[model samples]
Target: MKTFGIMTLNFESEALYIDGIAALSQSCGMECFHFLPSSINPLTQQVQGRRYSAIEQRWFDDEFPIPVLIYDRCFYGDDEHSKQCIPIVSWLKSRNDITFLGFGLPNKLELYGTLTTSRLAPYLPHSQSIKDCSEVVSALTKQKKIIIKPINGSQGYGIYYLKKNDKTIHVKTEKNKKIISRIFPNETKLCQWLQPLINFRPYLLQPYLELSNAASKPFDIRILLQKDEQGVWVERGKGIRIGNTGGILSNLSAGGSVIDFSTWSSSLPPAGKEYICSELNFIITNLPYILEREISPLFEIGIDIGVAKNGALWILDVNSKPGRKVVLQTDPDLKETLFLAPLLYGKYLSQSENKERKSNYEKTLYH
Candidate 1:
C-alpha cells in the first residue's frame, strides 16, 4: 500500500480534519501517518509519529520511514518554532523521493506582481508594498481611504482600514468578533502608530473600495478549487461570507457567517446576476492555471473576491492552505466528498508511473 503523511506544525492544529482524512485513507489503498517536520530524524530519515490502522480504526504511536506522499498543512508565524520548522520542511521538499500534494503559493506582494501581468489584471486591486509610514500618509491624502495588510497574513489578521478625516485619521479593525476603532488627531500620530507595525513586518497597501452591503456589512465570495483524482482542476464549492456590521473583513475567523451562493445570486437583478456569473466564471476558469504556470503546482486554492458598491469585482486574497469551513457550512451534504478528496488525489499520484516531483517549496506562498 502507498504511504500518505499529513504534516502540521502542531499535532492538534487540525485534529478533526486530519482524522477525517486518515479515516478515508485505508479504503483508498493507502496507510496514513501524521507527523511534524521536527519529528524526522536527520540521520535515519525516519519519523516519530502516529500511524492510523484501518483494521482497528485507531491511531498508534509508531516509528516509520518518511511517507512517499505528504500533505503540508503547516501554518507559520514569527515564532521560534516556526522559524525552525520552515527549513526542515524546505529540506523535505527538496528531496527527490518525496511528493507533496500541493507546493502552496507565494506571499501577497509576489502574488499581486504576477497576477497584474496576467489577463485577470483588471480584476485586481492596485497594490503597492508599504516602504514607510509616509507612503501610508500620502496614499490616504490622495485616496481618502485605504487598506493595509501584512504580506504574509491570514485569517483576516493584521488588516486595518484607514480613512482620512478633515484633520484626523480614523483607523478601524475587527478582532474576535468586535469592532476596534481609533482616531489619530494628526498624521504624526498616525505615523507613530504605523512605524512599529511596518517595521515589524512587510505590508501591502490598496485603495479601499466600498465593499459593504446595503446594511453596511462587509462581505465576499469565497471559492475553493482543487485537483481531482484525474489530476484535473475542479471547484469543490463557493459561498458568501458576511462579516459583522461596519467591519472590514468577511473571513470566518473574524466572526463572519456564511450563506449559500445560490440564495445570494437569486436575489440579484437579472442583469446584475448575469454579470456576476460571467465574472465569476472568468476568474474560476483562469486563476488556477495562471498561478500554476507562474509559480508552482497547487492542489487547492481558496479565493476571496469582493464586490464594490458600483458592481466591480475585485480579488481580495488567495490562500493555498484553505480551510473547509465556508464550503462545509454552505453545503453540509458535501461533508463526505470533502473528507475523501485528499485520499483520492494521493492515490492517483501514487499510481501514476510518469509522475514527477516538481514542487519548489522555498518560493511557494503559504498563508
Candidate 2:
C-alpha cells in the first residue's frame, strides 16, 4: 500500500480531523502516519512517529522512512519550536522524492499584491504594508475608519478596527470572545501603542467595511474549496459566520455562530439575491486558478467574504490551511467527504506521471 502522512507542528493540533483521515486511510488503499517535523532524525532521515494499524484501528508507536506523500497542517507562531521546525519543513519540501498535497500561500501582503493584478482584483480591498505608526495614523485620519491586521495573522487574532475622532482615536478588537475597546486620548497615545506592535511584526492596513447585519453583529460568508480525487477544484461547502454584536471579526475562534448559506440568502430580496449570487460565483470560480498561477499549487482554501450594507462584496481573507468547523456545522453530511479528501488527492498525486515534479517557484510562499 502507498504511504500517506499527516504532518503537523503538534501531535494533538487537529486530533479529531486527523483521526478521521487516519480511520479512512486503509479503505483508500493507503497506510496513514502522523508526525511532527521535529521528530525527523536529521542524520538518518527516519521519522519517529505513530503509524495507524488498520487491522486494530489504532495508532502505534513506530519509526519509519519518511512517507511518500505529506499533508502539511503546521500552524506556525512566534515560538522557538516554530522557528526550529520551519527550516526542517523547508528541507523536506526541497526533496524531489517527497510529494506534498499542496504548497501553502504567501503572507497577507504578498497575497494582496498578487491578487491585485488578477481579474478578481475588483473584489479585493486596497491594502498597503505598514512601515510605521505614522502610516496607520495617516490612513485613519484620511479614511476615518480602517482595519490594521498582522501580515501573517490567522484565526482573527491581532486584528483591530481603528476609528478617528476629533480629539481621540478608538481601537477595538475581539479576544477570547470578548469585545475589548480602548479610547486613545490622542494620536500620540495610539502611536505609543502601535509602535511596539508594528516593530514586533509586519502589518497591513485597509479601509474598514461595515460588515455587520441589521442587529449590529459582524458576519461574513465562509467557503471551503478543495481538490478532488481527480485533482479538480470543487466547492466543498459554504456557510455564514455571525460574530458577536459590535465585534470586528466573524471567525469561529472569536465566538462566531454558523448558519446555513441557504437560510441567510433566502431572506434577501430577489434583486439583491441575484446580484450576490453572481458576484460570489465570479469570485469562487476565478480565485483558485489565479492563486495557483501567480503563486503555487494548493490542495484547499478557506475564504472569508465580507458584505457591506450598500451591497458590496469584499474578499476579507483567504486561508490555505482552513479549519472545518463552519462547513461541518452547516452540513454534517459532508463529514466523510472532508475526511477522505486528503487521502484521495494524495493517491491521485502518487499515481500521476508528474508526481515528483516540484515547482521551480520560490518556496517562500509557505507560511
Candidate 3:
C-alpha cells in the first residue's frame, strides 16, 4: 500500500490534525506516518517516527522509509530549536528522491514582495520589511494608522495596531486571550517599546485597513483553498471572522467569532456585494497558481482577505501552513474534505512520479 507522512513541529503537538489524516489514509488504501524534522536520518533516509498501526488503530513506535511525499507542516520559529532543525528539513527538501506536498512560502515580507510583482498586486496592501526603528516611524508618520506584525507570525500572535494621535502612539495587542492597549508619548517612546520585539524577529509594516463591520468589530473573510482528488485547486470553505469591537486582529486565536460567509455577504449592498464577491473569486483562483510560479507548488493555503469601507479588497495575509478552526466552525460538513485533501494530493504526486519514471525508462529502451 502507498504511504503518506505528516512532517510537523512534533508528533504530540499536532496529534488531533494527524489523527484525522490517519483515519482517511486508511479509508483511501494508504498508510500514514507522523514525524518531526529532527527524527529523520539524512544519511540513511530512514525516519525514526511513529507509524499508524492499522491493526491496533493507533500510532506505534517504529522505523520506516520516509514517505514518498511529505506534508510539510513543520512550523518554524525564532527559537533555537527551530533554528537547529531548519537545516534538517532543508536537507530533506533538497533530496530529489522524495517529494513534498508543498514546498511552502517564504516570510510575509517576501511573500508580499513576490505578489506585488504579480497580477494580484492590486489586491495587496503596501508592505515592507521593518529594517529598523526609522522605517516604523516613517510609515507611522505617513499612515497614522498602521500595523506592525512579525513577518513570521501565526494565529495573530505578536501583531500590534498603532494609531498616532498627535505626539502620542496608541498600541493594541491581544495576549492570553485578553486585549491590551498601551500609550507611548512619541516616536522615541514607541520605538523603545518595540525594540525588544524587533530584536526578537523580523517584522513588517502595513497600512491598517478599516476591516471592521457596522458593529465596530474588526473582521475579515477567511477562506481555505486546497487541491482536490484530481489534483486541482478548489475552495474548500470560507467564513467571516469578527474580532472584538475595536480589536486589531480578527484571528480566532485573538478572541474572534465566526460567521458564515454568505450571511455576511448577503448583508452588503447589491453592487458592493457583487464587486467584493467577484474580486474574492478572482483572488482565490489566481493566488495559489501565481505564488507557485514565484515560490513553489502548494497543496493548500489559507488566505485572509480584508474589505475596506469603500468596498476595496486587500489580501491581508497568505499562510501556506494554515489552520482549520474557521472552516471547522463555519462549515462542519467540509471536515471530511479537509482531512482527505493531503492524502489525495499525495497519491496524485506519487502517480505522477511513477508515470514520469516509466516514460523515462521507455525512452531509454528506444534510445
Stronger candidate by TM-score (1 vs 3): 1
Comparing 1 and 3 on lDDT, the stronger one: 1
lDDT string, candidate 2, 1-367, tens digits:
9999999988889999999999999999999999999999999999999999989999998999999999999998999998888889888878888898888888998899889989988888999999989999889879999999999999998999999988899999999999999999998999999999999999999999999999999999999999999999999999999999999989999999999999999999999999999999999999999888878888999999999999999999999899999999999999999999999999999898975345633454344
- Residue 99, candidate 3: Cα error in Å is 1.2
What C-alpha lDDT values do all the predictions have?
0.91, 0.91, 0.82
Per-candidate TM-scores read 0.98, 0.98, 0.93
Residue pairs with backbone atoms closer than 3 Å in model 3 (clashes): none
Where model 3 places Cα greater than 4 Å from the true spot, the runs are: 353-367
Please state every model's RMSD to the true fold in angstroms: 1.0, 1.2, 5.6
Candidate 2 vs. truth: CA RMSD? 1.2
CA error at residue 299 for candidate 3, angstroms: 0.3
Instruction: Give lDDT: candidate 3, residue 272.
Output: 86
In model 3, what is the error at residue 347, expressed in angstroms? Answer: 0.7
Model 1, runs deviating above 4 Å:
354-359
- Error at 65, model 3, angstroms: 2.0
Compute the lDDT for candidate 1.
Answer: 0.91
Residue 156 miss distance in model 3 (angstroms) = 1.2
- Residue 180 of model 2, lDDT score: 99
